[model samples]
Target: MTAEDLSTGHTAIGSDPALDSKIKNYYTPARIIGTDYTYKHKIVWKNAIGFLILHLLALWGLFIFFTGGVGIKTALWAFFILFISSEGITIGAHRLYSHKSFTATPLLRGILLTLQTIAGQNSMYIWCRDHRLHHRYSDTDADPHNAKRGFFFSHIGWLMSKKHPYVIELGKRIDMSDLEADWMVMFQKKYYYPLYALFALFIPVWVPVQYFGESFKNSLLVCYFFRYLFQVNGTWLVNSAAHLFGTRPYDQNLQPVESWFVSWLSFGEGWHNYHHTFPWDYKAAELSMHFNVSAIIIRWLEKIGLAYNLKTASTEMVAKRIIRTGDGTHYALGNDDAKARVTAIGPLHPFNPSYTTKYEAPGANLNDQGLPLFHEMDVINVNNKNIKRNFTKA
Candidate 1:
């Protein structure tokens, strides 16, 4: 299971692991916020200044809304954008693209690409790469925004700072061939900057001014800045508040927790405890899709033949997983009746689980090789062409 993770198909593989150690020591380690992980956090003045300006503009947008500067239609438009933009990331980048929880047709992929382009997050390829890295090296120095670095760092601070060298080093090792193989993914990656400017900034601002007779200033401030700010923060909440707060019903050893508030805010990604437990589940959460807007939208797509091959962690697996590793916060924590309905599933190999396929989750039992659970992430059958674009990156 110590088989090394493949590269992004961008960088050459380094023979010496010492290169990671070399980068680690060269930088002055910062404060301990992410448990044991610490790294130099050099501020990027431009990103910091840009964010500050955006925050100020968003506040002005809010102030103007109260003073009749913007029409109700403009405000509603922003809200609508929020929903679709968030959907692109949750269902498109995270689930469909990153996890391979479901398959979407080329038409559906184009729609998701457009929506995600509006979101102004990085291209789907990069987004999935970082997401995979986050799962592969959760809570470690290699994690892009290690929650151990505290709420602010995990939330927004990581955006305004240079990536920790370890992040760059480990990031190169994350395989991205699957994403590269997708024509839609690479197309977006190639034109991401232009698409971001056109959809995320220009169009959002221009539409209100052109159609609604909203002032150019109001449209720019509210439709572009505030709407962007809101969606970005909502996404960050899943990274920050979801981890810092909530109960870890699935696995106490992990930092991610189940935060209902986060789910509501992030467009249905708040079920951190269950999500970290079973990343392959298309639902993300173990519970019903009462508030999961992303799950609901994905289901709607499935109905229309836009998405299929949806994967899930069955009730049996979830029930048994809770009994084996839960931190006693699960609803069925002490419900022996529920636990008795599902038998425990032992690991079949040091690598694969008898109950799960393709992707291995966070709480799977450690192997005889004494490798961490993350190592099993790369233990999948790489030769499977059917899942060439599987979200389980190297």
Candidate 2:
């Protein structure tokens, strides 16, 4: 296949930021093409240049500082900043805002938003808008970072080009009504640039220099630029590495897979198969949160009354999925032959009687409209009748 075919077969044309100001009028008629929905090529030079600059800065920082005698303190600061910034994307942008897996208190929300700014991804509003669309239309042309488009394209090239028209077209259909209602989310979008520079750039550099007497040059390179680069790459891995390199356990029909290496970098978001299978689950993985620092933080927030209404898939539901749609690549679970036969995803989670009773009555998990509760990633196929509900052993 050619590069464009390898890169998800998407086309962009006639770049203009003005069209993006309002979703309804977003489409430019000139950009629209044949019945198959293809368009000509158009690159967004600003985003392309921005990405180039970031890469150059990261390389310069690594070469000059590491080879030219940077202090140990500065290196540690870079490491610490990477972890915190990754959490800002994984927890704040992905789990909290995009999935709504759990409710956060205003205090916790404020903290996450501040950390998100420090992470230097865009405001949560804009981030979630694209993310929700990606999950809903994954692997298709509508997906902003569709993995079928190849690694480099999905990883960073999507941002470097003008969005495919289908992105704006199908993207506008996603009900952003909920997002429009949140003043805090809106406030961040309104003042995103200023906040990003202050929180993401200034504070990181300021902290090491002010507290530990580090040189501004070393602090800027190690703490700010390099740290930002690390977090951005980690975030990109969810769309690229997790989808391309890992095993698909939850649903082989979907392209997303569970990648341990990516989970380590992104703070627990690399369980792509489980995540795509059960997007409403706060933990994202079927197993424990041991590898998922984001889930652990959410639990801690729950204990301190900063989070509530944490959602998780029933043991029966996950087990059923493993047996049916799973690619047979997960961990074994339980004494039951039926569950154990297909437990190829992760460590088995024991079923909770009370939790099961609360949400598993006939049509229990359905929404008010009698449709299954759908998140951006999950697609429920409830036609199978031989679902084994027992998950007591592992």
Candidate 3:
């Protein structure tokens, strides 16, 4: 069906009662009462088998390459497969579609959608729907990959088990009109399985053998098996490690954490804490910090006019909201500085009811010397006097 046809068929910008009922019914605590006792051994076994086979094939492929069975050309092909698949998940699936952090041209979007299909994840629609739910209800029971559900559940257990009611019923709750309007996304949603079979499995095997002189078995092993395994687990880490460990710079209460190590592995997505707090920020990490390769690519696309509306957070605003927990007290970094400066002026806490919170003077954009000013108080004078007193005592 054409994109126009699909758009016309679905109801636009309206609530779905069925979805609401399902969410309300499933999200209730009573539904989870007996879930703890359910048999999960089969799910565990299946994941174990899948994981084991993937590693076994990857290790075997590496062993063959080192043993003079596979040449450098084959190794290069393997690397290509891994790179493209990782980009598909990070740039295409997560950033562009799930978050709408930026807009790509139709041609670029189509190319990205095709690449993402090869990763063997669900269609863009399914992935985006679940991911939106994840963001909306992060760390709560309604979140599809809630970290509170334990490490394994967030990582892979959710996929192995029966489809959660939320998956089947919450379709209407998500505002995916933009995605639905895209022809490429709609096509991929309907025909993703066939595309996976052809491009991911058969084409990888046939094309390399026919054109590049690679054996069918080697192509399957290196391109299909090894690439597939790497992409799946790498994407999974965003759910498991991104939440379980790392620094919560933006919001301490949120489950997502910022880890430079995880960011490197997951293509700049490891800045989970900042992402959770500022979901629309395109660059997950700060510019002064370690560069996020994915953000670099997106910026490049923007420069070339292929991408637009790249969302970003101001450095000052980001710094202000960053939470610092030390000495058994939590404070907004921006507010803390302001409070400290105000305290120096008078012996009153900013939050104290008796304190006059109002300032009579008009805010100055700069000091007398015309130096650029900030929200923080002028502490140079106070620091100089304290230094003089200490020097005199010494």
Candidate 4:
């Protein structure tokens, strides 16, 4: 379909009138109803096989001791990999690359890229492309991982399923010029597969054996397989658990929520409600930094001159958003006194350099047709333009 057809919600497209009519009957660009005639189980074989292997390896973790006990050193190394690699997604992919919440120096950017590669998530370019689509379409059929599809589908099923046609079609609307222009992002995408094997697969197993004198079998099963599985599920929880449960103080209209349990697992990316509400916020939360390691690391980078131009919603901006759309689950939602207290909270830290003198409240912008665009749609388009300008300046 042409951009005009999609914008007008016209079901028909293409040059041939007969073919367009047949296609229109099969698919409607309006909205995805899982029960629609077009809906079908499109299995992604490679992802299915990979996921099956990972799950079996996770089960093997139970019998790891009986197989051959993993040493304390090996287990510790596995845990370390788990945390850092997961942060690579939460900090590198989500906060930095996808949202452009903070700018990183070349050296720091390289380190984050390395860690993200080791995490085994796709290259930053691919991850950001899918992520922007997710935010733009949200619970609609076009969302790459639409939560409305159900917990399992939203969590990992989308990865193992054939991507919906709308996902591919609408994804093209997202301007990726910024990501494409980045030398580092493009380089990573160009060499993603080989780099993934070298960093994610080989290094994890090789380290325990070469440095810790671990048996190859034990290292492969425990440090490499089990650790990789843990990190994958932890990241998945932010998409599943965070979306389906928890409090929605920021915006009840959005499906995403805040879950402390998910926060701990995701290394502080559990503030989903606020994240969907204010995607540009560096912290991804309106309140405490206690659970947000991503924000902390960005702050530290700012201090060392490795990160800059960190974006965050101000107290007034956050308060206005909550008061307008909050579900009253937040303590600061109702009373004037409570709201004041929330606003009174200081910057992330005393020395934090990421502060904004003016706050721009998140909202929808109108299309040429005069209807307001969805917040996510506005975000993707607007952010791309801003990042492109920044890239040119840099």
Which candidate should be chosen as best, given TM-score against the real structure? 1
RMSD of each: 10.9, 13.2, 17.2, 9.3
Alpha-carbon runs more than 4 Å astray in model 1: 1-38, 334-394
Clashing pairs in 3: none
| lDDT (Cα) of model 3 | 0.62
lDDT of 1: 0.72
Q: For residues 277-324, what per-residue lDDT tens digits would candidate 3 score against the true structure?
A: 666556755552463788888878878988876766565556656634
| Per-model CA lDDT versus the true structure | 0.72, 0.69, 0.62, 0.72
Clashing pairs in 1: 33-148, 33-149, 34-148, 34-149
TM-score of each: 0.78, 0.75, 0.69, 0.77
- The sequence of per-residue lDDT tens digits that candidate 1 reaches over residues 120-237 is 8888888888888777667656677777787888998889999877578768877787788998889899999999999888888888889999888889888888888889898988
How good is model 4 by TM-score?
0.77
* Model 4 C-alpha lDDT per residue in residues 221-264, reported as the tens digit of each score: 88778888889888888888777756567787777777777876
As a TM-score, model 1 comes out at 0.78
After superposing candidate 3 on the true structure, give the runs of residues whose Cα lies further than 4 Å from its correct spot: 1-55, 65-68, 166-168, 288-291, 323-394
Higher-scoring candidate on TM-score, 2 or 4: 4
Question: Measured by TM-score, how close is model 2 to the native structure?
Answer: 0.75
